[model samples]
Target chain A: MTTIKVNGEVNIQPNLAEFEFKEVLSSDPSRKAVFLLLNNKTTGKAAILVADKNPFVEDGSVINEWIKDAKLRNLAQNDIYGSYELLMPEKFNAVKSSLIYPATDKHILKYRRREVYMIYETADDYKSITKPSIKESLFNLDWVYNFLDHKAETDRIVFDDPDPNIGFMLAPDLKWNGVDVDNLYLQAIVVRRDIMSVRELTGEHIPLLENVRKQVRRVVKEKYGLNPNQIKMYFHYQPSYPHLHIHVINIKYEAPGAGMTCIFLDEAIDNLKIWPDFYQRATLPFVGKEGDVLLNKFREAKRLNEE
Target chain B: MTTIKVNGEVNIQPNLAEFEFKEVLSSDPSRKAVFLLLNNKTTGKAAILVADKNPFVEDGSVINEWIKDAKLRNLAQNDIYGSYELLMPEKFNAVKSSLIYPATDKHILKYRRREVYMIYETADDYKSITKPSIKESLFNLDWVYNFLDHKAETDRIVFDDPDPNIGFMLAPDLKWNGVDVDNLYLQAIVVRRDIMSVRELTGEHIPLLENVRKQVRRVVKEKYGLNPNQIKMYFHYQPSYPHLHIHVINIKYEAPGAGMTCIFLDEAIDNLKIWPDFYQRATLPFVGKEGDVLLNKFREAKRLNEE
Candidate 1:
């Protein structure tokens, strides 16, 4: 299994590379990150949506049922808006917490439905169902990668990273000592089952992939003193997670700068440039420091359980 | 004798592949410019020390006698402290017109002496003199040539023209506009005798050199508007007229703005990279347009006399 580490926190997932992560509640930092894992039903684990609280109920199915019920009532609200921020209990089965409201006043019943969970049978079902989405995340990742590699070159050029599993891009907005620096972009596929299955297919060792992620986190934190905000860790086919491989992605949007740095594909980068389709377009919202803190807490809890 | 033309202007030096022109001192809208002529010495034209503005005195004998007279009287007041500015006209019978002063207050008479019509005994005599330089006006033409040849490039960078004879450089002191347009370095070398000699030695024709300078100028002006005081051009040896070659270089000290166009050296600038040493260290000065007006007026008067 590929273990993706971001800013020193480890995230475990199944062998599949594609995944999407997001934040459903505006107030909860621990539950701030939500992920959508997808692969063709022919190859990937069954689609399951997990909550920080009720890990088994699958929030994806609950959200789908709620949407259908709301449509029957002809709610006439744009509930499928890409992003909806609300205040509520962190999880589903928590003792009756006061219903949190959205910025708009319309949804009293929806407010009572605080955190919904659900599941889907196919990739198409997932795409058709979710409006505020994680499915389109991978496509955005590909776009950002293309832009960073071709046009962003300054008088001083930076070298591209050596690993194919891990792609690191600097944010255009980041700066050091008043000089604009690029924000970082990183991607890696995670697996939960046999690591050898991935190695035989992609010809890359799973341990090497994990090590690269750890190195990236150490370098970024120690050298740049910043963290990714939208972290996407994709997992498929559960026992929730132990049966899955987690592919981790870090994306920081609205990064603070105007400079762009190109990732040159030279002789040194030849081998890394050719990657498998599974690793293509899998993107995650990079969790910045707050998200990183939650991830570290999760990793510590998992490590203690294993011990 | 490969004449390189950027647009339509013909550069005259084999060493120079481009020219950029700017008027350093003009409130007028016309933006007229002047070119300095170097190596204009004629074999039989009587290099004279004009006590009463005569042009027919002996080249060496009369000059030496006059220098002797000034040296004896000014040995204490002039010799120990006073510079070439004080002794040049009195001793050598050369005019030190107030046309070519730099922006600085502390002027060096030694440098200004080079501005006067000093004779080069032989090409080697011209080669040996250092303080009163004649090399830059000859060398920077090579730099300009390299700058224009799409194949021209070198790790060697220039902050200021090394050879005053080859040409001069200037940048706009931008205050009103928030944007810095572009840094401009200009050089013009006038060659009647030296061109003839280099042609014989290198087996190259002279007209090819003339065409290159004109092309560089046209490209720069078309790309960036011919803004007054935004740039400056220096004529190599304008004291004597006719045969002239110039190297004009301009680089933006600060970015003008987001939309401003910068005439960048194309990636293919390698032609002048392999030139021989005939164009190195030529001496010339970067002077302003007030000086240009005086020199232009002088050239017009001489041209009228010739006609």
Candidate 2:
């Protein structure tokens, strides 16, 4: 084992073994990291050492293909799907000498690229710019229809509500790996096909909304042992698919698109109750990612307050 | 100079000089990081090298007291306040060899601890729980008053509106280092003292809100060359301070409390227009962090559906 030593000028010398393991601060099984608090034996100075599993790289030449001395423990098996904990040979560990490290240029670029725009979508803009752009070809709902018809992912469905008007089918979202309970994520696909998005909802749809919320809370509690308050239910404005669906996630899970893009189900219900024509008349604001067609449409229409 | 080499089994051997500098992918002056795309001369494989400045550690013994070959670049200077870029010698660099890495237990714990709870606050809950708890002892507004009176941060103030009823003072938030224009952040503190938060806003405050919005946009455009659409104006539901201050930020900046805790100024205006008593009667949902007194109050009142 190669040992690293630090001098008064904080120079890295490669001969002396200085670190003596004191205690483990934290451990993450998923990330495969253990933060160990160590004391320098010679100088008696405390230091934090992060021992993490190295991630796979895109370069094929750097990776070793052989899986030597492999051991597998079955975690769960359902139908053809099986989850296992694999123990392999010669796993490389990346050690971070300390937590205090300057962020990389890639990190800054990533942050810079995450520039979000809030589009103040008026009713006219929705009709002229949004509605026309969302052509049927934009999203392929054949798979969604197939799933609703029980022709796909039949085994994965947690519960199905057959009522066509005031019902939805609950299923684990693809994002959830079905392993971590703290980061539980589920989706409720409505039975009705008429409502394209939250923009289409009215006071008449209150029952449907309430029913979905109630059923979701009940099933989540019964199945996952998660209380109603422990989970958040919301809808995406520019949802990935045209089909109306509600995202039900554990409160602990801070999913992407939760900020400016999400509208709470409870807020929707209350708004509808307050005004029957709330969705129709209200100038809604939603985030548009860079280079989105809808955003381009807004730009072309001169809807954005840009110079 | 120390060199690292990798073999078929990916062992970290510290003798061979294998990497050759190819190109610089990105650079962040603020983070002091440079991402260099390198090619292994011996193996003819490409790799990403993140050259980052080592951060200051808490342990005093590990730090060097001497500063050699130091240089300073004055970026800006204003009335007893100045900003400079410091260049110091013998700065250590931390290198990350690969992007793929296993998350550690500390990362999981940190993510898990960010569990946000949304409280469905009613008028009764506000009166009985929220209002009574904020007994003026919670937040000391003396510094704010001092600033408003031109006794503090007077040099930092961008502009001031003296009208007590429909006026505010715009200043850069302390959180903004004032170096990065992309992550520009400013605060608009209302002149009037009666209004506590968004909850107090009715149709009467439309002028105040609109004035703040307009002035913020105009000043930002004139001074920073940022268009109206490139910035966002919002209010924190359970604000850090009771004073009714609006947060103005660049679209690229994603502040910590921007999610469920934030209420857009436009939304507030729209809601107030829709119903004069919208804030008064509405079941406002705001996020409460873990161990917050308000969260505890909600728990005691059994407002949360936790078991």
Task: Tell me each candidate's TM-score.
Answer: 0.16, 0.65
Cα-based lDDT for every prediction: 0.25, 0.65
Residue B223 in candidate 2, Cα distance off native in Å = 2.4
lDDT of candidate 1 over A83-136, digit per residue (tens)? 111111122222111111111223222222232111111222222322112233
Model 2, span A58-92: residue lDDT tens: 23233222112333344433332223343333322
State the TM-score of candidate 2 restricted to chain B: 0.64
The C-alpha stretches of model 2 lying farther than 4 A from their native spots are: A1-115, A135-138, B1-115, B135-138
B73-166, model 1: which lDDT tens digit per residue?
Answer: 1111111121111122321221111121111222222222222111112223234432123333343455344443323443222222333233
Model 1 compared with the native: what TM-score? 0.16
Per-model DockQ: 0.00, 0.08
lDDT of 2 by residue, B1-307 (tens): 1222323233232111355554555543222334445555666655443433333332323322211222334443332222333333332212222210122334223333334676777777888888877763467788888988999889999989988889999999998886677679999999898877898899999999999988988999899988888888888878888899999988766564445566788878877776778788766778787767878888899987674
Q: Model 1 segments beyond 4 Å from truth?
A: A1-115, A118-142, A150-208, A224-307, B1-307
**What would the TM-score be for candidate 2 when compared with the true structure?**
0.65
